[model samples]
Target: METIFGLDLPTWWFLVVGGVFTGYAILDGFDLGAGALHLFFKKEESRRIALNAIGPVWDGNEVWLVIGGGALFAGFPVVYATVFSAFYELFMLFLVLLIFRAISIEFRSKEPMAWWRQLWDVSYSVSSIMLALSLGLVLGNIIQGLPIDDQFIYRGTVGDFFNPFSILMAITTLSLFMMHGAIYLVMKTENRLYAKLTVLVKNTTIFFVLMFALSTVYTLLYLPHMVERFKEVPMMFFFPVLTILAVANITRQITKRKYRFAFFSSAFVTAMLMALVAVGLFPNIVLSTIDPQFHIDIHNGSSTDKSLKIMLTFAVIGVPLVGLYTGFVFWTFRGKVKLDETSY
Candidate 1:
C-alpha cells in the first residue's frame, strides 16, 4: 500500500478509531463497572468505599469518551452523522442516562441523609447498566447494518434498534463490564469488600464465559458470510483463544489472591478481544446488507488525500501531548482509594 505523509489515510483512520475506542474501554470500563457494582454495596461505608475507588480517577477516565467522540466527528463525520441520526432517539436516551449517572456520582455524597445517598446510588447503578447496554446495542446495530437510501442515509426507526443480535451484544457488554469492575476492585481494595469481590468474580465468571460464547455464536449466526473469511485466515482465531486463556489466568490468579496480576490480565484480555474484532472486520468499516456498495469501506469513507495529509501532520504533533497528559493523570492517582468521612 502506497503511503501519504508516511501513512495511508484509511489505515490511519482505522488506527485512530481503534486506538481511541480501546483507550475508552480500558479507562472508562472501570468507571462503568464500579458504578454497576454500586447496588452490591449494602452499607453506607461500603458504598462510599466503592465510590472512592473510582473517585479520584473517574472524571479523568471519562475524557476518553470526549476524545473518541471527537475523533469520530473529525475523522469520519459522515459515519458519525449517519449513525447518530439513525439512532437519534436511542442516542438521546443514552446521553440522558449517562448525564444522570455522572451527576449522581458527584452529588450523591453531598449529604449524610440515608435516603439521598441511596437514591443516587440507585441512579448510578441503573445509569451504568443503561449506558453499557446502549453502547453494546450501538455496536450490534452497526455490525448488523441498517436500511439506507440512495442518499447514503439511514432509513430505519428506533424500533429497529433492538434486534436479537443487538440484545445479545447488550448482554455481552453488561457482563464484560461487570467482570472488568470486579477485577478492578480486587486490584484496588482489601478486607471484606475485596474478599467479597473475589467471591463475586468466582460466581460471575461462568456467566461471563457463557455470555461471551453465546454472543460469539449469535454474531456468527447472523453474519455467516464472514465464516468463510475466518476459515481462510485460521490465524485470526489466536486472539479469541488468547482472550480465553487470559480470562482463565485471571480466575486462577484471583483464586490465589494475586490481585495485581489479575487486574492486568483482565485488561489484557479485553485488549486482545478488541484487536480480534478489529482485525476480523478489517476493510469494512460498516457492513451493509441492502447493498455491498452501501457498506462504508475505509478506503471510500476516508477524507481527501490533502486533508488526511494535513491531519496526519497535526496528529504527529498533538497525539504525543495527549499521551503525556493521560500518563501524568494516571501516575498522579496511582494508589488505592481511601474514603474518609470528609473525603470526596
Candidate 2:
C-alpha cells in the first residue's frame, strides 16, 4: 500500500514488465524474425548462412524471456499466477513450441540429410509463427481485460481465452515478427541470400501492413477501454504514430533494397510498438471485467520494498554488464554469413 522511494510498487511493476518485454523485442525480435524468414532461403547453404548469422546470439537472446518470467514470479506474483492459470493450455503450447524451435535450430544444422534438415526447418519456422501469435494473443487478452471472480481469481474457460480480439492480436504480432525477421535477414546476409531476402521482405511487408490496419480496427472495436486510455493521453499517442512511420520507412527502404536501414527501422518499430502497449497498460496491470475491486495494481502484486531495493541494486550492476557482453558477441561476429557447403 505504501509508495517505494517515490512511486508505488504498481508503477515499478509496470516499469519492469514493460522494460523486460521491450528489451526482449529488441533482442529476440531479430532472432525469431530470422527464424520466421528462414523459409525464404531455398538453398540449404543459404539457410545455413542465415542460421549462422544468429547462432551465437539466439540462445543468449532468450535470456530476456527468462528474466521476464522471473520478474513476473517474484515481482508480480498475482499477475503471473492469474495469467498462467487462465491460459494454461496456451502457455503449455507456447513452451513446447519455444523448446522445439530452439532444439531444431541447433540440431537442424548438425545433419546433412535433406529430409532431416527440412523437418527441422519446418519446426523452426512453425515454432516462430506460433510464438509470435501466442505473444500477440497474450497482449490482446491483457488489453481486452480478463474475467476475474470475487476472490481475485481467473474464471476463463479454454474457449473463452481465444476470443476474436485476441486472435487478431495474434495475427498482428505474427506479421510484425515476420517483417522484423525479414529485415534482419536482409541486413545480415549477403550474396544471393540477401538478394532473395529483399524480395521476401517486400512481400512480407504487405501482410504486416494489412495486419496493422486490422489490428487497429480490432483494438478500437473490441478494446474500447484501452483505446480510451490512450486517447486521454496525448503524449502516449506519439509512439504508435512513430511506429507506423517506421514501418512505412522499412517498407520503402526494403523496396529500394536498403537492407541495413530497413532492419534498423523494423527493430525501431517493434521497440516503439511495445512501449506503446506498456504505456496503454499503465497503472493497471490486471483489469477485471467482473468487478473493479478485483483489479490488481503493481503494488498489490509486488514484493516488499526491501526485496525490490536489493534487486534494483543488483539490476543496476548487472544490466550494463549484460549489455556489454551482448555488444561484444555481436561485434565479434559482425559480418555476412557464409556456410560450409560440405556441412549441413
Candidate 3:
C-alpha cells in the first residue's frame, strides 16, 4: 500500500524486473544474434572475427539474465515457481543450451582440427538460435496466458508452451535477433567481411521486417487484446509509433552504410518493443486464460510490502552499479574487433 511518487512498491519492483530483462534482451541479444548468424561467416578467419567480436562481452552480457532471474525469484516467488514448473522441460533444454553455447565458444579454438571446429560451431550456433527462440517462446506463452489455478499454480504441462502462437513468436524473435546480431557484427568488422555483411544486413533487415509485420498482423487479428492498454491510454499508442520510426531509421541508417547508428537504432527498437510488452503485461506478470481471477498479478504474486521495500532498496543501489559496469566494459572494448593469437 506504500506509494513511491504515487506508484506502489510492488509496481516499482515490477518495473525494476522488467528493466533488467530489457537490459538482458539488448545486451545478451546481440551475442545470441551474432551466434545465430555465425555459420554464415564461411571463412575461418571470418568466423573468428565474429566470435571475437562478442568474445570479450558475451559472458558479461549474461550477467543481466542472472540478475533478472534472481529478481523474479525474489519479487514474484509464486509466479516463478508456477512458470518454472510448467515450463520445466523447456527450461531444462534452455539450461543445457546455455552451457553448450558457452562451451562452444570456448572450445571452438581449442583445437585446429576441422572436425573439432565444425562440431563446436554447430553447437554454438544451434544453442544461440535455440536460446533466442526459447526466450521468445516463454514470452509468447506469457502473453497468451497459462492455465493457472486459483492457488496461482500453473495447471498446464510442458508441452503447452509449444502452442502455435508461441511458435510464431519464436521464429519472429529469431529473425529480430539475427538482424540485431548482424548489425552488431557489421559494426565490429571491416574490409571483405564487412562488405559481405553490408549485403547480409540488408537481407536480414528484409527478413526481420517481413516476420515482424506478419507477427503484428497475427497478433492484431487473433490477440487483439494486446492493444487494449494502448486503447485505454491513447498516449501509450506512441510506443508502437516510435518503434515504427526506429524501424524506419534502421533501414535508413543501413542504407547509408552507417552501421553504428544502425546498431543503436536496432538496440533502441528492441528496448521500445520490450517496453511495449512490459506495458501490455503491466501488473499481470502471468495471465490466466481459464479465468481472470486466477491471474498472477504484481499484487497477488509479489512478496510482502516490507519485503518489496527492502528489495527495492537493494535494487536501487544495485541496478545502477550493474549498468555502470556494463557501460564501462562496452566502452573499454569499443571499436572494430581485432583478431589476435588469443582470439576464439
Candidate 4:
C-alpha cells in the first residue's frame, strides 16, 4: 500500500471523493432548497425572484456532482458499480428528475402564459424535493448497510431501500436543504421577499432542528455502529460538537439578521454533517448487512496504486482550477438579485 503523508492511497482517494460530494451538497443544496420552496411563493413575481436568485449559479453548482461521480468511479469502481447496481431504479429516477429540474429552470420564463409558468413551477419544486429525498435515501441506506454478499454483489431488492430509517433520513435531508436554501434566499433578496424569507427561515430552521434531533436519536438507539468510531476515538467527538454549534449558530445569526453569517453557518453544517458520515464510514466504502466479511473497504474497492497516484496528480491540479472558477462565478454574482428583462 503506497502511503502519502502516512495515509494510504485509497484513504486519500476516499477523502477526495468525500470532499467533492460535500462541495456538491453545500453548493447545490441551497438552490434545491429554494426550488423546493418555489410553490410557497404564490405571486409570479415572487417566484421569478426566487428563481433568479439561484439563476446565475445553479448549473455551475451541479458541476460538483459531475466531479463527484467521476471521482467515485476513478477511485472506487467496485463500490460505484455495486452501489449503482443496487440502486439502479433510484438513480435513474434521480437522473430523470435532474433533467426535469434543468428543463423547468430553463423553460419557466420562456412564456408569459400563467398555465405554462405554473406547470414548470410545479415540475421544478417537485423535482427538487424528490432529488433531495433521493439523495437522503441513498445516504441512509449506505449508513444502515446494504445487503452485499461476499463477492461484493448487492443482494437487496429495490423495495429494501425504502425502510423507515431511509425515509426518515430522506425527510431530514430535505429539511436541512430547505433551511440552507431559505437562508441563501434571505441573503439574496430585499424588502418583501426578504421579510417573507425571514419568517420562513425561522420555520425552516425549526424544521431542520427537529428532524436532525430525531435522526440523531434514531442513530444512537438503532444504528449504534454509526457512532462506534466516535466512541473509540473520543477526540473525534469534536466534529459532532462543532456540528451542533454550527446548527445552533444558524438560528442565532438569523435572529440577529446576519444572513450572510447564517448562510455560512448553514454551509458549515452541511460540511460537518458530511464529515461525520465520512468518519463513521471510514475504511469501508460500503458496509454489508449480510456478513462482516462482505464489507467493501477502501483497500478492496480501490484501483491500483499506480492509477491512484496518476489520478491524484491530475486531481491536485484540476480540483484547484475548478474551485477557482466556482469562486469567480460567485464573486461576480455576489449581490441581491435584481429583476431585469433578462432575469429568470
Alpha carbon lDDT of each predicted model:
0.77, 0.79, 0.91, 0.94
Candidate 1 residue 289 C-alpha distance from true site, Å: 2.3
lDDT of 4 by residue, 114-162 (tens): 9999999999999999999999999999999999998899898999999
Cα lDDT tens digits for candidate 3, 1-344? 89999999888988989899999999999999999999998999999999999998999999999999999988988888988888888999999999999999999999989999999999999999999999999989988899988887778877788898899889888988999999999999999999999888999999999988988888888986688888899999899999999999999999899988999999998999888888888778889988988888898898999998898889999989989998999899999989887778
Candidate 1 regions with alpha-carbon error over 4 angstroms: 1-7
Name model 3 segments beyond 4 Å from true: none
Error of 2 at 283 (Å): 0.7
lDDT winner between 2 and 3, please give it: 3
* Candidate 3: Cα lDDT at 137: 99
User: How far does residue 201 in candidate 1 sit from its true spot (Å)?
Assistant: 2.0
Per-model TM against the reference: 0.93, 0.92, 0.98, 0.99
Give the Cα error of residue 181 in candidate 4, in Å. 0.2
Predicted candidate 2 versus true structure: per-residue lDDT over 258-289, tens digit per residue = 77888788778878877767666667788898
Ranking by TM-score: 4, 3, 1, 2
